[model samples]
Every structure is written in structure tokens, then in C-alpha cells.
Target: MKNDYLFKGEDICKSFGSTQALKNVTITISRGEIHGLIGENGSGKSTFSSICAGIQKADSGKLYLDGKEYIPSGTVDAMDKGVSMVVQEQGTVGKISASANIFFGKEAMFVKGGVLNVRKMNQEASRVLNDMGITHIDPQVMIDTLTFEDRKLIELARALYTSPKLWIVDETTTALTVNGRDILYSLMNRIKEEGGSVLFISHDIDEIMNMCDALTILRDGVMTATLEKSEFEEDKIKQLMIGREMSGHYYREDTEESIGEEVVLEAQNITGGVLKNVSVSLHRGEILGVGGLSDCGMHDLGRVMFGLTKPDIGKVQKGKGEKVKNAKWAVEHGIAYISKNRDREAMMTLCGIKDNICLPSLKQLAKGGFILKKSERNLSSKWAENMEVKANSVEQFCNTLSGGNKQKVVLAKWLAKGSDIMIMDCPTRGIDIGTKASIYQLIEQLKKEGKSILLISEELPELIGMSDRIVILKDGVLSGEFYRSEGLTEAKLIQKMI
Candidate 1:
């Protein structure tokens, strides 16, 4: 039997100035099927989706919806034609209530006789949230007060409210917890049962294999291959996406070396909103991994250690015998922090890669009480090459680089400063396997140099594989500690956390 196609794009091409982002790519989505798109950074997954959602127009090609030619000039135009997208970076208004954000662009629905109807909108919003299995958030509460994971759920709920025939979800699950992901998976199943098509994009291939009916692979702005469910394998997918087999050595080999005698950082009796009476010690030449479930206070601990947020009662002692009172003090003490919100906290989007990399190390680049142009350029170019940042040039704007490359730049900036203690919060959050491996190698190199690291991450495997010692935080306190020699496992760590 022949399958019906809900959406089809043939010979689609798009370019940004001289750089071609998509090269004669073709894709088709069938009704009631969840189609997965997999690729490395800058492989056109996001570009193709943007074109489908009407955020950008294809330079050349044809797009057909339900066997009819369709081309939308903007997102509103696409929505009017039963197409909607849930973005990864979040596009909702933070000052408004959750209900208002869901129905923001379609406010006319709540208008009656030239007057707004708040009661009707709230009732409908409650139903929509319930359909997505979200219960903790109130419809009347402002969006800014919600957590990042909750805001992600709201984006999905808003797309569902549109009653779209074609739903595009772009890396939306990265922020969600296990239970939240289950809710989203159930919602996708319901949509499929109603004969709706979904285009799911995620860096996690495991999720794509489990949820998608078929997979499309792109590499270097070209469609590499497409595979059916019967042909799905994690390694095979990785090979296709990167155009080579991955070494599978994500973490450094365990050399079983003892931590140095020197203490790099120490936190005493830290008390914050989600952290209470927290005390931890990090030594030189050590990678300390902090892990726990969502809301377990691990993230808060990182912030307190970095001095991004001052603890109500606590002290951070640095290697220089100086106590850090705030972020400025931390920086002065050779402490560098890479936040989880890379785009918002770690990067300067409008600046060039050279500027971004050299920003954190400006103190060293200045000569005679003025910035040295030649020194800055030499430093940035050297670090960019060493980190393998794939950009046209160091002068290229950071906003134009891919997610993995941007993350590399963020790391480069901190490494350039030669910081003694580094606090990495979700450093590999949205990067691909190849880039993640590079980061792991870099971390190992830093450890070999005797620099201390506090690695705060949500992935259990990463914590177990990389950290010399694993510290589990729960309810604003340290629950358990596991040494690498003791043989740490996810199940045991989780049991301790609960």
C-alpha cells in the first residue's frame, strides 16, 4: 500500500550570503507519523525546520502540503495553514501569565463585543494544560516565575492549542525531566492517533529511535541518508550524522591517580533558596561531579560556588587566600564559571568570535593601560585553532556559528583566562557526540595540568565516566558521595538521591 504524504519538500535550497546552509535537500512527512531529523551542528536540521515553519524562505524549491503547493512567508502564515513550531530557545513573553502566553498571538478568540473575556480564556487554557498533563503550574501566574523546564512545557502546550496538522518540535526535550518527557511522549501519541504529523528534532538519538517511525540524517548541509525503524541503531545513526564512526571513548581513561594535596576551593555552610548547610571541598587535579534529579539543588550549589548568587549564609574560600563575596570577587580569584544558559549568560551573540574569546582575558591583553590589537588577535586565533572551533574566521559573529561551535567558543573564552578553578554547569547541554567528546578530552587535559574542576551535570553517565568522585545533592544537602574506585553506578546514586 502506498503511504499518503502530509508535507513534502523537493530540491529545497537555502543560503546565508555566500554560505549555503541547505543543498538541494528533500524530505517528506506522512500523516500520523513522527519523523525524526538527526544531524551534527550546522547540518541544516534547524534551517530546514525554520523554512517549514515559515521563519525563513527557501531560495529554490517546492513545498507541498496535503498534495497542494504551499509557501508561507512567515510564522503566522504557516500557522494559518495548520502548521506550528515549538522552538528550543523559547519565544514566549515572560511578563504575561501562562494562559496569556498560550493564546498570545490569537487574542481575538477571547474578544466578545469589543471587550476581552478573561474567564473564557482561563477556562480554555486550563483544559489545554491538563491535556498536556501539566498540573503544578497555575494559569494566572506570570511565566517569568516558572522554571526553565516548566517554560518549555508551556511552549509545547501553546503549539498544541493551535490544533496544528503538522507540528515541529525542535530540541524541546533537552530541558525536561523524565516525567515531563513521558507527558510529552503521551501527547505525541495522541496527536498521531488523530492523524497529525510531527517532525521531531533532537540531539538525543535514543529518544529519536524510540519515538520516531523513520529517521532522516543530514551532514554538512546535505541529506546523507534515511532509515526505517528496522534499520535503526544508535552507532549507525551517529556514523551517518557525523560521516564517520565515533571512537566511543567519550571520557578519559581512568589512570587512578590521587588528587593533589593542595585545596583549590572550599565551600562552608552554604545556605540559599534550594541549598542549605552545603559544604564541599575540591582539590587540585580533580574533577568533582555533582548529580541529582531535577529540583535536587545541585544547580543551586554551582551558582553559589561561582558566586553568581550570594548565599544567605556561607563562605567560598579560594586558592589565593581570598574569600569570594560575589561574582566579581570570584573572577578576581581566577574562578571561571560556564552557566547552563549559554546563549543568555555565557555568550555575547552580536560580537565576533575573537571578541567573545578574548573578553574574559582582557586583563592580560591590555598594554600600557590600553588594549593591544595584535596581542588580542594572536590569542584568539591560536585558541580558536586549538579548540577546533569551526568558523569561517575568528572575526565571524558568534550568532552565525552552530550550537556546538558556540559552546566551544564559550569554553575557549574561559580556558584562555587560565583560571585555576572552573565551575562548568551543563557544559555539554545541546552539543553533538563529536563535540561532546572533544569537551571531555579538554576537561581531562585541564585535570592533567592540575586545574581543579567542579562539574555540575544532569547526565548520570557523564558524571560516572568523568568524575574522580561523584557527589549527590538532595533537598539542599549532600546525600551521598561515591569515589571512582568504589565503582559508582546510576542505580545506586539514584537510590541515595531519593
Candidate 2:
């Protein structure tokens, strides 16, 4: 007998105004299986999954649960039917305690009559965290105090607590470290063993191939193909997903010459929490890539260099000018940072695309003690067009844009500022191949213009492809450095990082 499908979507059609986001798409997820969704940017993967999780309704589709016709009005209705989604952007209140945030909506589980049961909530939260192997976090600690990776784990734990039969993870692993990813993978295996289903979405093809039983490809809002494990080939999957052959060289060629004599930025004896006695120099017209396993202090180094965090005993000197010790100082000194968490640190969701793109350049665009709307719009329009930001217009709100477009808008904002020094933290976290190519081109252009960039990314291929020099950090120390000219390999970098 054929296996019973836990969830099925047929003839799904979704539209955003005049744009058809999903066109006649159909997908079936069987119980006790992990279904991997692979697609390029703008490919209706997120939209279809969102519809499955009842975050949005499709224009035309028939959904079934246990072979029964099902249509949910909203997320709450979906949750009632044992469907839940952990989105890429964290959906938790940061100022609240972890326990409070975990059980925010389900207060009845921790509330008695008119009083809140803090101890019960804490106990339940602790149990959930422990089950997920998250030992560093305390239930009573504020969510704001936790790292991005930890907060994401907390979100996963919350989703698991819902006892979801079908769990949708949308690009959730981009923030997680190796250990955190392992925990999630183990949980997924357990969930599968317990007869639960998962819709796994990510840009990392290797992870999908390793963990998923089947793969579904989407492109231009259309379902292209679905392949079983036996038919899975990385190149074929890429071709079907993007409708084109993927270049093996995702990284840039090391055709650029050696660094010039000018030192654009330098950090000496930097001693911050998780970063000890670190020193590095960034030259003009060079891309300096920082890499390591998560917890290697590279992230903290980026934060410190961009002046987001203070260093205990270090100085960031720009050119021959004064040293920067804070974010404001970095900004004033023509230094900009694109954070790994684009939603939280980069874009303003409630604002318009034009506003988001021009935000970093407001001072430059101001005139006569007043903000110049025309200049802002013109500047934003130029960058939007150049960056190929897919939006109806600059007037469109950023929250309505896709993940890739939002990232481009963030990059446009910083590029509009014309910063001499840029510290990009995972700028392509959830972007598609096309957008990633565009970003690489932009970086190349910046390098040609003699700008200095310090790139901190988790994706090793990207670091290898784009950096003129790769710096590997391990346990709060600079463990190794490789020049692109010297032919660095993943093995060598991993060896140093570990």
C-alpha cells in the first residue's frame, strides 16, 4: 500500500497584485518524511510554505489534511490543525524573559485564575530547552541578552512545543552554528521517527541532500520538478531549480592585483569579550574575508570593528584620522556595517523601500536644514535600479518585499552612503543565486573604487571566492591567515579554525 500523505496542496495559485507568485503548484508531504524545498529567489517556495502554514491564503488551491479537505484562515487555525512554521526572521519579543516569550500566546498553560504561574512556565521552558540540548540559556534571562543563534533555537523549541505534525522551517539555519544545526538536525530525525513531517527550506544544497528524503524544485513561482533520493544529483537539482547551469566558481576569480600601499583601516590589540589581542589591517581596494566555526570570535570582531560594541583594550584607526570606539564614531568616519540579521539590524520593515535605501544617506541628502525628498527619491531610485531590487516602486513598504529584495535594499542604503570602509556580516544570508551574483559584482565594483571591505561570513565558498585574504579565527584568537594568491583550501581553513 502507498504511504499516506499527512499534507497535500493541489493546483495552488497565489498572486500579489498583478504578479502571480505561485502558478499551478502542487506538493505532497508524507508523514515521517522531511521534504526539502529548493528554489531560486522569487520562486514561490516561501509563499507556498506560508500558505501551507496558513500564514496566507492561496488564490486557487485545494489543501488536504489526512485526505480531508482543509482550508485555514490564519496561522492560529493552522496551529489548531497541527501545522506550525519557524520563519527565517525570529518571531519573539526580545525584552521579555525566555520563558515568557516561549509561552506568550499559550498563557493558560502557565496561568492560574488571574495570576501567572512563573515557576511552571520556567520549568516547562527549562524542559524544552534541555530537550533541545540548549544548556547555556536560562529560562528567566531576557531574550535580548541571547545571541541570534540561541534565540533561533528558542524559536525552534517553541514550535516543537506546539506538537506540530507538519513543521515548516524557512531558511532558519542561516543563523545557527554547527552545533546548533546539529541539534536541529537531531530533532528533525526524532520528529520523523515520531511520524511527523517537515518542509525544510534552505539555500545550502548539501544539507538538503543529506537530510531530506525527497526534493521539490520551484522557479519563477512554478513547480518544476520533484525527485526522490535515488534521482537526487546536485547539478541536476541546481539546473531544475534555477533553469540554468550553475557555475562551479561561485567565488570571484583572484584576478585582482595585490593590495596598494594605503592602509584604509587597522585594528590593533583589540580586546573585547570573546576577542583577545586581535590585530588586523584592511588595505584599500581589498576584500578581507573573516571565517571560522561559529564562536571563533569573528562575529565579535566585526561588531567591535564597526563600533557596535566597545573594545576593552584596542583601537580602530582609520587612515591618518582619529580612532573610532563606537558605532556613531564609525558612522561619522565613513564606515558602514551590514548586519547578519538584516530584519533586526538593517532594514526598517514598516518603512518604504525609498526610506530604507536612503536612511543611511539622510545626512548627505539633507539641505538647508531640511530633508530633501527629491534627492532621497532620486538616489534611492538609482540604487534600486542598479541593485535590481524587485519591487513595484520605491513607495512600496519593505515588509512586503521578498527576502532577497530586502537584502538588496539594505545594501543599497549602505552603498548610497558611500562609506570608505564596510564591514559586511553575512550580507547574502538568504539570497538567491542571481542576487548573490549581483552582490559579488557590487563588491567587485567597490573594490575597483578603492574601498576597503571586511567580510565576515559563515559560507566558506563565498569567503574563498571573494576575499583577497582570508583570516581564520579560533576561540577568540587569530589562528591563521591565508592569501588568495597562496591557494587556500577548505581543509586548511577548517584545520586552522578548529
| Model 1 clashing residue pairs (backbone) | none
Question: Per-residue lDDT of 77-156 in model 1, one digit per residue for the tens?
Answer: 89989889986666778788889998878889999999979889888889999877898889888999988888888888
Off by over 4 Å in 2: 1-3, 255-257
lDDT of 2 by residue, 256-326 (tens): 44677888888889998989899999999889999998888888888888878888898888887568768
> Residue 232 lDDT in model 1?
99
True lDDT of residue 441, candidate 1 = 90
Global Cα lDDT for candidate 1: 0.87
List residue ranges in candidate 1 displaced over 4 A: 255-257
Instruction: State model 2's lDDT.
Output: 0.87
Instruction: Estimate TM-scores for all models.
Output: 0.96, 0.95
lDDT of 1 at 398: 91
Residue 227 of model 2 has an lDDT of: 88
| Candidate lDDT (C-alpha), each | 0.87, 0.87
